[model samples]
Target chain A: MVLIGINEFIYVASILFLIGLLGVLLRRNTIVIFMSIELMLNAINLALVAFSRFNNSMDGSIFVFFIMTVAAAEVALGLAIIVMLYRQRQTILVNELKQLNG
Target chain B: MIDILFSIFASLVLLSALAVVLNRNAVNSAMFMIVSLVATAGLFILLEAYFLAILQILVYAGAVMVLFLFIIMLLDVDKGENFNFKTRKLSLCATILGVLLLLALILNSFSSNNLPSVELFLIEDSSFIDPGAFDNKAKAFGQLLFTKYMLPFQVIGFLLLVAMIGVIVISKKPKF
Candidate 1:
């Protein structure tokens, strides 16, 4: 039998990811949306680390390292874009910035 | 003992994540995000990834969250959008859908028959592992990173540089 303890980490990861997804879909605030994205990334990292631990390998952890680097870069660029967007539009609500719908 | 700790950290992570999503104040949400991230780092340590846990704290909780708070303060947002009756209904539907999805993942489909049965007791001790072991220790990570993953490591460095330049250009006030 597959022990419940073994798969519990995966379960938590899934829940965390779902919460992040809900955040992105429901929140109009751009900053909160960005935070949701970070939460999702952390969830994936948790699952990867769990898998690495179970498999007795280092590959997944290494992959997570790369993921963190990418996440850091993405956050810096995304926030910069948000700042620039705010400068041009003077608002950060997603719904209010539909000028490109044309 | 480890399982108990795991449950605590996981619950902490989920609750704070929910707070991050549901909170109206951007600053409060960012603070909750820090809590969620740090709790996730705790989970990493439970998984025996000490190096990753530290990186999670330093890079994610420390640097990334600070940047988020900085942007939030710089924007000086007056108030968050209110969830009217329509959004409340929409969120209700979304919550139902998400809960169903979680049930599908955790209940019927993810049984042991489909998964590779690795021994869970390997991490029971939760003590300091010897350096020679091929676990998630820092020494082993360095060896693997320097050997098979060297090219990708360099590529990630270049990607960071590119992202830095792009951010600088995008955020700068136009000279003209």
Candidate 2:
């Protein structure tokens, strides 16, 4: 029936991760970088679930909880930092954020 | 049966992922990211991880994406049309590099032998949730989370509390 095996999921995850990587490297918007980071995290989550199914273990699924928690924390802190930066700098563009580049 | 569903969701996830990167507007990127998230959650359901699927939709697509949109609107960050993230030459280089990396990953994947296991074995005495059943995945997930993974659960709770304080601290106006 469902023949999408474990490695296929991994391949999908890797491609998503690479896409996120490209976004991070090529896109200069801080928000886009944050979104890319989330994309990468989701890719890891996919791999974790796929492996859990393949191994018949619930441990991998449990890891997803931890990952999501950390991701939430990251987003909270990251957005706060962005907001703070915007208050000081007036723009969210990455190219203009060079005051601290000593 | 399930394969068809999986293929559909997987492609949608990838498509929305591309939208997240390629869309010029921050709001559009955030919305497409939510689409990608829900699709990935659907794939999780196809893997019989019903709890994770629900959690994915609820936590990520629901709570997290909302926060993203809130931040985007609060700052008025996308008022004007701005497009140049990098020079065209740099973007071209990045595209070529990313494609090369993808090709390498796909080619490398074909030659490897996959792990040889598929039978699900549940922890003994966890009676309510049958590991192989179509339903009750949440029970198994809760059982594991409450028992074997209790420490991490509590730890994550503490992490959330600290993160809340940190966010408030980071966003406050500096008193000079």
Candidate 3:
């Protein structure tokens, strides 16, 4: 009998967030790290939606709408940057992306 | 019934989230992320946020994820053979940190729901809404967004315009 509560949702959000953090830290590839960042943002979205439910307000829901918009913009820009990086460096690994130091 | 729906979707979200991290291939990770996002939208529906649930499916699972797949295939980015790692220390640390964070969140959730924000919203709403009236949530949010949040909304539009220009300018190939 899995009794789901608001706390269950919170716990799920926290675990997903930690997974995102580890993914960012452990993965060396820039694409993988970028995916991890998206995962973290999704976790935030989950928490916001859950809080909006319990708090009985439209504010958090509206906030999530804006967050979604910002996320779309971020993906567009980030993918462009990734494409440019690959063209310039011939690789997408984060460990090898220090061309700015020159 | 709701609890069952939540459990199923939540499990799907967790499994796909783990897959996004553990998969060696970036393409596979992106695919898994789409699954995770879809399940997240399902959870939003359970929470009765209909508009957000639909937006999550449309924007995140549809548009954004397709963009991810496009970039991945276009870039031809793949992981190399140097993939193995010493999981002993890192996994242990991550497990400990995760457990601690979950514990803190669980404890906080179990306590009373007397949060200031909750209280404030209750006062503003002034009465318990009928379950049939949940659709009104979207209406209220739309109204507030257009009125009180209008300025920020306009700013975000401008920000998106700027970001578009910046990306094109930055990614443009410089001629020698």
User: Tens-digit lDDT track for model 1 on B34-150?
Assistant: 999999999988877899999999999999999999988988874646651126777798889898988888674556465655665453322235422336557677877787898
The residue-by-residue lDDT of candidate 3 on B1-176, one tens digit each, is: 87789889999999999898888888899999999999998988877777888889999999988988888888777745267222467757766877787777777766776233322122234324632222325666666768778998998899899889988898888987
Ranking by TM-score: 1, 2, 3
Candidate 2 on B131-172: residue-level lDDT in tens?
432332577667777888889899999999999999998988
Using all chains and alpha carbons, the TM-scores for the candidates as numbered come to 0.89, 0.89, 0.84
Where does the lowest 10-residue lDDT sum fall in candidate 1 chain A? Answer: A1-10
Per-residue C-alpha lDDT of model 1 across residues A1-102, encoded as one tens digit per residue? 224344778878988999999998788888888999998998999998888777666788899999999999999999999999988888988878889988
| Candidate 3 accuracy as TM-score | 0.84
Instruction: Name the candidate, 2 or 3, with the larger DockQ value.
Output: 2
Candidate 2 has which clashing residue pairs, if any?
none
Ranking by DockQ: 1, 2, 3
lDDT of 2 by residue, A1-102 (tens): 446677678878988998898888888788888999999999999999888776666788888878998998999999999999888888888777778898
**Model 1, C-alpha of B82: deviation from truth (Å):** 3.3
Candidate-wise lDDT, in order: 0.84, 0.84, 0.78
